[model samples]
Target: MNLKKLLVLVLVMHSDAGIAQNLDTPSIKETSGYTLANLSIDSQITMFYYTDITPAVHFYGDILGLEKTLDWSWVVFFQTGSSSFIGLVTEGHDAFHDVQPSNAVMLSLVTNDLDLWYERLRQWNEVTFLKSISDSGPIRSFMVEDPGGYTVEFFQWLTPTE
Candidate 1:
């Protein structure tokens, strides 16, 4: 079987076990005929460029309460969720050079406690509140701007009867 097939088989077996598997250390028998290269595309990390990372750190870490996983001076990584990370690259860095910040993309976060987040963020004078708490369709949401001028939306999904 090809590498992809082998990986699928292993994943299927683990899934059938009905237990959470540690992605850092996948259990695979050598007899399965799969190598490390076959599972190279393990996880993905999303990144955003910034002219300065200090504000990014303050916004994501201090304000949003995301854990700072890595700090590489020019590049910093924040743990956004399980197996998900957001990287901040400083301007003049190869990855951020010539790139302009745009409102075309917004980082959205879904939460069960929208009111709590709103209360907390409102207390911070640095937070730029674009929209107040409002219910629209099936979601209750609000918008804020980070120091980098990026729009961040916080929302909670409303139940059918709500």
Candidate 2:
């Protein structure tokens, strides 16, 4: 089976939320034996891009210990959980640049301790902290630009009692 078909089968089987009526379903063309599916992702998936050469794969693999689902061309997919994935794509690559690429998208991360990441990132020479811990009402978070200009955020939500 082709990669497209394989992806469809995997998604269909592992879909956390049942397919709703409004969802554009994947249809197979009879003659071609190929299916055309909308790349409409569920809410859990996130895609991030990098412009210059960076060790994103290493960071996700070695540091974060995420297994690669697919690594091809300028795109790399890392499986975060059973149903979630993290996408890393080369910014200048045709696949990504064909559409407008924006650095304005801030990746928000909910972690156990924001200070742990904030302290750890300080040891990395390549990473730059954009802001110290900032309060957003009930949450305390910090933003750091990674080696490839992608903002890696770490945050913790404050409880009402705390």
Instruction: State each model's CA lDDT, in order.
Output: 0.75, 0.65
RMSD score of candidate 2 (Å): 10.2
Q: lDDT tens string, model 2, 1-162?
A: 543563365456545665553343354345455433534556466787665324887776665556888888588888866777778878665654432354655555667767877777777666677888877655677877755566766777667564
TM-score of 1: 0.69
Error (Å) of candidate 2 at residue 12 is 27
lDDT of 2 at 7: 37
Tell me the lDDT of candidate 2. Answer: 0.65
Runs off by more than 4 Å, candidate 2: 1-43, 62-66, 80-82, 91-102
lDDT leader: 1
lDDT of 1 by residue, 103-134 (tens): 45566677898999999999999899989999
TM-score, predicted candidate 2 vs. hidden true structure: 0.58
Residue pairs with clashing backbones, model 1: none
Weakest lDDT window of 10 consecutive positions for candidate 2:
20-29
